[model samples]
Target: MTFTFKKAVRSESKLRLALEGISGSGKTYSALRLAKGLGGKIAVVDTERGSASLYSGLPGIPEFDVLELTDSFSPEVYVDAIHAAEEAGYNVIILDSITPEWSGKNGCLELADLYSKGNSLAGWKKVTPLHRKFLDTIVNSKCHIIATMRSKAAVSMVDGKVKKVQDKTEQRDGTEFEFTVVLSIDRDSHNAVASKDRTGLFKDPEVLTEETGKKLLSWLSGAATISPEIQAEAEKAAQLGVESIKNFMASLKESKPDQHALFSDAEKKRLYVVARKADINATQQGK
Candidate 1:
C-alpha cells in the first residue's frame, strides 16, 4: 500500500500535519526533518520556549524561519505572520504552537467546545465579531500547514491504585484547551511517537507509508497502514538489508585495515523473498 495523496500538487496545497506527545517525544526535531524533506520556507511559530533556534542550527533545517510570540503578544501578530507567508507563496508553513494565544486569554479548545460559539460548529466565537472575522480570513488562505500541541503523559488509576493505561493527555491550564498532536520527548529511547494524531496518520495506531512499514515491520506488531507504493519500497529495503546480513560483518577491525564484501546472490534472493512475504502480509491485513 504505497500511499500517495493523489490530490494534484496545488501550488499552495493545504496540509495539516500534526505532532503530539508528552515531553521528550522528539517532536520538534522530527518536525524540522519533515520540513527539510518537504524543502521550502516553513514558519516556526514559537509559543513554548525559543527552541526553534536550536532547530535553526541543525543541518536538517535548511529552510527554517521563526515566528516568536511572548506572554504579552496578541493574536493579530500570529495572523499577520501567517498572512505574510501565504501572500508570499511559501510552500510550507508551521504553527509550532497555536494554543498559547488562546491560553493567555484563558480560552483554548475546551472552552471552544464548551462555548457553542467556539467549535467548528459556530466558527470561533466572535464577541465583537472582529476576532472571528480575523480567524476566518486566515484559514481561507492557501498554505501548507503543520501545527504542534503541548502534551503531558497521563495515567488513569482504575481502582485509584492499579494503573490502567498511559495516555497522551491534555488538560486545560485554565479556560483554555490545547489542540491535539502534542509530541513529547522520550525518557530513554528518545524516539518520537505520535501519542495521538486526530486524523490517524503518522501516529500510534501507527500509519506507516506502505514502503516504510514493509521495511520496518520485522520490528513491530501493532496496527499499521501502508500504501502500495510504500509496500514496494519496503521490499527493496528488505532486499538491501541482505547485503549487511550475509557479510558476517564485524565492527571495523584494527587488524584488517579497510575491507568489505558484497552480498552473495543467494543471500539477496533469500532476503527478497522474505520482504515479499512481509509485503503480502501487510496487504492482507489492510483488507
Candidate 2:
C-alpha cells in the first residue's frame, strides 16, 4: 500500500543470456564455451536430439552433464529440467535451441493448435500462462541460464536482387527482451553481435569463446546489494515468532505462490533461524 525509494545499485546476479543463429552457426558450442568461461558445474537441456553431447571433452569446453528431451518441448518440461539442474547443483544451464519450445513438435505452438482445434486465438489463451511461467523460471532461476534460439533469414531487395540477411530469432517476438544479453550469430562467420547488452560488455561482433564467458562472470561479480523493501520484509519476518513464521509462510505459499517460489532454500532457512531467534529473545525477556 506504500512506496519507498533508494539509491539504485547493481547486485551480483546470475546471467540470462540468449544466442540466436541459424543452424550451423555453432550455438551449442558457443554456449558451452561461454559456460566454460563462466566457470562452474554446467548442464545442458538438449532438445536437439543429444546434439550438445557431441562436443564433450573437446578443448576449451568443460565437461557438462546433459538432459536430453526427445519428445516434449512443452514449457512445463523445460521448467522441470531447470529445477532438476538447480537441485543437482549446476551453476550454469544451457537450453540448446529453445526454438523447439516455441515451434517444434509438442511445443507451445502445437499445444496452442491442439487446444484451438480450429481457432488460433482460443489456443493461445490456454498456452500463454504456461509460456509466461517458463519465461519466469528462466528469469528467476538461481543458476545462470544461456538459451539458444534458431533464427530465420530475413531477405530484402538490394539493388533489385533479393539478398538473404539474418537477425530475426524464431521464438515469440520480443523474447530477446527477457535476456540481459542477446547475441545474434552469423552462420557463415560464426561471429556474434549483441542485439541486446544490458551489461555494456560487448561493443562489436566477434567470435564467442571461453573468454567471453569469463568476462561476463567478472562483470557479474562486481557488486551486490539488496533492495530496501526486501530488507524491511526480512526484519518483519524476523520479528515473527516461530509459530507465526510457519503460519506466515503457509499463507504466502497459498496466496502468493509466485513470490513464495522465488525464495531459495537457503533464504527460507535464514528466515526460520531469524524467527526462532526472535522467539528465544522474547522468552528471555519474560523471565
Clashes of each: 28, 0
lDDT of 2 by residue, 32-85 (tens): 998987778999999998899999988988999999998888999999999999
Please list the residue runs of candidate 1 whose C-alpha ends up more than 4 Å from where it truly belongs after superposition: 1-12, 71-74, 105-139, 155-241, 244-287
* Cα-based TM-score, every candidate: 0.52, 0.72
Clashing pairs in 2: none
lDDT of each: 0.48, 0.83
What lDDT does candidate 1 reach at residue 71?
51
How many angstroms is residue 77 displaced in model 1 relative to the true structure, after the best TM-score fit? 3.2
The candidate 1 region of ten consecutive residues with least summed lDDT is 252-261
Q: Candidate 1: deviation at residue 178, Å?
A: 13
